[model samples]
Target chain A: MAKGEEAAKQLPKVLVLRPPPMFKMFEKEFSEKFQFLKAWESPIPTDQFLAAEASSIEAMLTSGSRPVTADILCHLPSVRIIVTSSIGVYHIDLQECRRRGIAVAAGGDVVSEDVADTAVALLIDVMRRISASDGYVRGALWPIKGEYPLGSKASNCDILVICCALTDQTHHMINKQVLAALGKEGVILNIARGSIIDEKELVRCLVQGEIAGAGLDVFENEPEVPREFFAMDNVVLSPHRAVSTEESSRAKFELISGNLEAFFSNKPFLSRVNIDE
Target chain B: MAKGEEAAKQLPKVLVLRPPPMFKMFEKEFSEKFQFLKAWESPIPTDQFLAAEASSIEAMLTSGSRPVTADILCHLPSVRIIVTSSIGVYHIDLQECRRRGIAVAAGGDVVSEDVADTAVALLIDVMRRISASDGYVRGALWPIKGEYPLGSKASNCDILVICCALTDQTHHMINKQVLAALGKEGVILNIARGSIIDEKELVRCLVQGEIAGAGLDVFENEPEVPREFFAMDNVVLSPHRAVSTEESSRAKFELISGNLEAFFSNKPFLSRVNIDE
Candidate 1:
């Protein structure tokens, strides 16, 4: 037998629905342990590819961006386990996984410290205008304009930080009334999912100078942030990257590899998602 | 006596060379307790003003921006106390103050919390490129440019934070060798004085990409930062505003008032600087 075929036959199969962010960089290292059946590399439609590999495939790996819906799962009859390199499993149909008796594992608390650090960074960024003042200095305005205007004393302390999971109950939790109570001097920071805030109301509040400012990582319709925020200096915008760090990425790779190894060896899984809920 | 005279007679006399920042906001409130001898408001020269008011002025109030040279002190023989609304008293002649036996008061630990907050804010801003990403989003680059390139992941660890006071022994303490030691991935944050780091060597290091980046609040010269820093997105520049928050300003005002009141009442000074060194 050819060496490639021999290696493929000996290694356990793991289907990759889509590559996660920074996945390509670690592909060679991962290929040694598990033969990743890449659906994206196939010319056939995803459903056709899944149907062709139905009998052979028993587990899959996916990213946060791809949806693992019921329709997508229907093609993979023999699949028993799925692993995603993301903390949020909102894209995965938990009910469908539960119905099929399929197990799931996700990124664990590796990102918690980085996310907390981001929260403070964003909070201070919005409240103290650190980002804005940096711009002012970079724009060469300091020489002409003298001292940058005073920023709100954030350490004087009136702040709201959002880090809750996105759920039906949590949608639009930070609405107008809560914002009103937070008042004109208050600042808000969101490292959680964007839909948790009423973005429209937030835009209106910012436009009318009701709330002080915001530092946001995620948005309701991401990659399409509210254009109004572009002109405002008080607000600091991030491209949904609060949890992304080199250290966290390394930890995630370890966890994903560990979970896959445990599943193959019939051991207890690390970071298994309880799909019954 | 007239009503104004009656009030002035009961109030304590204090001399002001130039007003502290935000002085106008609290001028009326301050005037109620102390009779301020405004030298800047005089038509005569500052020396003439000081010469004229030498006997009546027992205490002088100054800001961080203005200098209190030995020449100025020569004209204020009766001035027993100097109260400055600033954390750093480098502008005041400490040796002169000591020789004349005049006690000096400054804006002490009031700004410590705010300054520390700024240190973290700048650190994350540079490491995560929060400000740069905000600018990219604002410039409408997200859709066209795809994802903003990944920042160095400041939470990935390596960092240097400079928060020590600048003294004769500490000037240019963070020179080329230190920057070299910090190396390619290390980011440096300076919330201390500008002269503590060799600005020329820093510019060379940054331009050559020897070190990762910097977050600077103070500069080598007041109102004059090295022009090279303006172009580097890795650097976060602040116009010496780490201590200018409103809450700290209020604290500073209270401290200044307390110090002046104590000096007049023959009581212990608050935040008195031991200028013997």
Candidate 2:
């Protein structure tokens, strides 16, 4: 009978969990354009409180950290869809969502390019000792060590890249075609899951002085490195952190907000995580 | 006349300190075609020993390490000119050579391209963390932490380069025009030697952060970097060691040998430390 009731009847009621920075834009636009309930707070209270207060909520917006767990899904029985702000759904229980007949969306490709760029940056920094040099400067040890160990020229050296996913995008980023154009003259160092590049392959290359050196951030197991690596003079290494950048974070937020808006409008979400066959 | 004396009168003696792997080719050709003495051993003992034993030595060969120092120059006073197979006279005392009026020759532009290529490689390596990541792989630690810091990209970032010379050769190696073409986004960092960089304009550009970072190998003061430089995060700093590479040792050896050959032939030396004014 009322203008607001008429609008609500035409649009879907939505609830957002841990909204990103750009959520404000989505809130302003969705409030005027569609029926939207943006619960952008954290430490969500008990299920009874949500069920009693948000019985009308039809869609839930979330991200990688605060996944829509089975318990949370049961409480939000009226919710027909879930939208995530990340590519990987490792956090969300897909089977639970399927049982509840809730649609899911995620953001994957939006952040891949930025991740690839950061990977290359990490590789170069490790090889050239940029961060170490920075530490030296901060320590006031200028003119540090033996002239930063001159590496073979990029154009003249070979480059080797070892990774699990050789998809179109990843292929484009590290393919031989791109490498040749970039004037790299080295072999690749891809071990499956970052675990295959054993100490032997690395030691052999370094000791024999075969193919200049390598750049790697992934490994077999994580957080545990061998002592022998620390002793070597010609290798560079870092923890698995190629995809975490400030830009990636911002992009992830934007994707999440966009997906939330589309879901609340009953429109086809742009980043559906699990599509029905 | 004695049987050997008649044959010896037509030949010249050449003393080679340490030649490159290619020296064997020269040995074969010169021995079969011309009369010459080639001493291939490194660390040629004492000056007195060389003078007494190699009195007939018409030419002396040396490299960066086995430089034809003023003392060595005095020993080989009969040697008309000196030759080196590499560039950079830091090891070979140019002042001493000038004081003695000795001519020196070196490999002209042979390794400039190579060195330049390596400089770019070092820049990429430092900026990208290549060595560190590779080191991690070798250490058996996969999935390196902080592998790629977010928002660290090369495009439109500031750069700084510090050097002591802006010779035509170095100018070509790290030319601002070329860098601008690559991505007009950085500054030059030169402080080691006056000859390392063009001083007048670099200061203005550095203050503005026009470039995201720098590649410094030298400084105005022999070892003292400016106090202001200690705070900048985007710049790459070194103690004037852009040219030190594993290949430099062999290149130096070859240059020294070339110098020895030219000194005996009464021809122009290869890597002259001091040219006739």
Candidate 3:
């Protein structure tokens, strides 16, 4: 065999259930370190693809949207570790991982600063009506309709910014009472998870003018937002892109590589999940 | 005369060309300190109104929208000070103020922090496509479009924020060469005067894809935006509201009152402009 092919054969193998977003950009660099068995690229069924390399593959990679279920775990008997390119591990079956003694590395503080920035952006966007007024100007209404109504003054705003982990206690923490307290002059900004706020109540509050406005990056059922939000100029909606930044993406790629390298060297995983919890 | 009427007659008289926006909110508080000679409220023409008060009015209040031209100053021969509720003193002729030895109290550092906050909001809004994507979601395009395009990463943006005073030398400072230097990946944000940038070249560059985008608050002319900009999703246009906030307005009011009080008391103006320059 040629030198490059021989060198590739000697590298450790990693099974990819599905390629992470922009995986092609990191493909060459990833290939230099380890061989990735791209399950999606193969024309075969996913289970059969898993079954073919079930005995040989010792590590796997996944993203936030892909679920690492118990059934998938059962198929990969030799898989000792799972690496994800997201801050949240809700998609992973931690109980099954613990039972199998498999280690899981997560996307941790790599996105912390980016998320904070998004929160600030959302807060300012909602309070200043940045998006709404931009729309007014684009709609060619500035000359005809005159000044867009003044938004809540930034220095005088009673604003709430939600930033917390999605836990049993934290879920649905911002409900009707919270909305009522926010009253007619307050704005809420959420770059955190959607379930943290009661969406139905939020809609009701907005519709009735209980609360002034909101900036939401995540929803209870993402890609399935309540249609009521569609007509509200006071609300700024994002496609769950709080952490979707190029720097964070590159940082995640580096972290995943580091985790795999540590696993191969028999060192402790960086940002390893405590499955016992 | 009644004691209250006599007391009001004894207070310092200040001429207001037109009641500033939201003047009613401040009227009661302002009346207690100064007796205002409101030009607009009078049935007479503006020059006639000014002529009537020319001999007695020693102080004048103006907003950014109102011009304190040489002709207006000529009509108000006894005016010793001009107080404006805006950061820019461009509406008042500095040379005329200098020639007449009349002090000009410009809106100073009170609005500095608010303007900075606005610049940040505009920067993040444009770079993240916050307003554009918000429009998509509000238009019910999110469900149909699958995903909004990823905006330029906040952490990897080549952004230029313009924050300088407008001057004869500084006019059209951001020209075609500067735009070319900024190149196709650059984004420009201007919260300063619109004339500081060559708006025509900016339009051409944006049309030809020579530069990435722009976020503009101030325009070359008041309330007259380039019509071509209405169609571009890459641009974010604000209606010259960078320093607008309830706090800033309050601060401006207090400063204006203080300046008038200082003029009558033989004290230094709180925010006196060195018009001799």
Candidate 4:
């Protein structure tokens, strides 16, 4: 039989909404088990392609920052399950999924430890000026610049460490006054989603010396950080990869594959998320 | 009274062998208790100055990276005490101090926590590609480079963490074979003195991909890093400042002062190092 004919003999079709950039590494492995309907790769528009090709698709895969919105879900009437390679379902229309009775599975507790480790790493890098001094040494400015500026202590103070999800209400929660109260010696560390803090005001605070420094893992427009931050020795920038160690990536792949396999086999989902919220 | 005479009358004479750059921040406070004969500032040669002026100097303050050699110690016949603003005293001639029965006080447990924090920070920075990505972001190459290269996982492995003083025997302990055993994915972190590792071999291993990455706070040479390391993304360089935090510095000031006070007052030193070693 031809390859397409053999592929048609696979299990239930799974629509993949914007697979992660790295998903291609595991694409062949996943495709061997289930036929993937690539909505993003269609020559036609997504909606028309989904309606024409994925109308009978009962399972879908979402990974990275792809938003599985209600409008898109309107086309997937047969989607009984949505398996994501992300721990957070904020990108998915959870309410719509609830109304549609679509079971949701997330990339469970595997990433929390890595996320916590990244948070601490960013914190120390900011407060101890590790990344900045690293820049100085790398830039060959140390012999000329003398001592790189001293950074404030990370502990033994009233500094607050808050890590939470960035919902509508909590968006832009860390505004100017909040940073002001944090004071000149205050350090802000953000490992969560960047929209939680007002990035513009954060830049302003950091530039004006209203706040001391920051260690940022995520930005409002990721991969497009402000140019102002580039020159500042006080800020440390990390690409939005707090939970992206090789170990974590392997764990994520296993969990995602397991979830898809479980869904197809009609077994209990491994890491089902409550879609009711 | 003249400034020198008045200063001499007000405080007990204590020689300072290369005072820390930040010592001036606390120098006035320290000077209230002990008259510091600045060896580095002497017009005559250091040996000549020590023989003519500091022969009667019973206490000496060493900070930063100044070497208190056996030859230098020969000039100080009356030296009974030495106080340093560092936890590591590889720069000081311990055998001579032992033979002379001179009590040496060092920055004690106060720096251990900060040093450990730095070690962890460097490890995570190297393993997570934090510093490299930070540089990429700063250089405005993220948009062009796409995602930064994935880094090796740091934990759940047979990772060895060693922090110790650089002694004659321990110098060059981490040579090519040690690094080779660490393999292509191992990461080496140096927060102690630089000579402990064969830095040339380290550079060669890193360049040849024999070992994965390194995070070096101290180098075989200070303020002068290898030009090759300047271009490498896998390496993170810090200017020998693993124990430098504003909070720790204040604690250090208190400890150094207390040690000096204790030594002068004929009380047991707060952080006296065992010179018998």
Q: Specify the highest-lDDT model's number.
A: 1
Docking class of 2: incorrect
Query: DockQ of all candidates, in order?
Result: 0.60, 0.22, 0.55, 0.69
Model 3 lDDT tens row, B81-186: 9988777787898999998899899888988877887888898888777888787777777778766766666455578888887878789999989999998888
Residues A127-210 of candidate 1 have per-residue lDDT tens digits of 788888888888878888887777767655468898888877899999999988888877889998899999999999999999
Identify the superior model by DockQ, candidate 3 or candidate 4. 4
By summed lDDT, which 10 consecutive residues of candidate 1 chain A come out lowest? A149-158
TM-score of model 1 (CA atoms) = 0.92
Candidate 3 docks at the CAPRI level of medium
**Model 3 / residue A134 / CA error / Å:** 1.6
TM-score for candidate 2, residues paired by index: 0.56
Candidate number achieving the greatest TM-score relative to the actual structure:
4
Question: Cα miss at B244, model 4 (Å)?
Answer: 0.9
Determine which window of 10 residues in candidate 3 chain A has minimal summed lDDT. Answer: A148-157
Ranking of models by TM-score: 4, 1, 3, 2
lDDT of each: 0.86, 0.53, 0.84, 0.83
Off by over 4 Å in 2: A1-16, A19-68, A78-83, A98-104, A126-130, A133-241, A244-277, B1-152, B158-165, B168-185, B189-195, B198-212, B221-231, B239-277
Please give, for every candidate in the order listed, the TM-score of chain B alone compared with the true chain B: 0.94, 0.54, 0.94, 0.94
Please give, for residues A24-89, the per-residue lDDT of candidate 2 as tens digits.
Answer: 534655565445554544345656557765676777766555656887777776877777665556
Q: Report residue B22 deviation for candidate 3 (angstroms).
A: 4.3
Which candidate number has the best DockQ? 4
- TM match of model 3 to true structure: 0.90
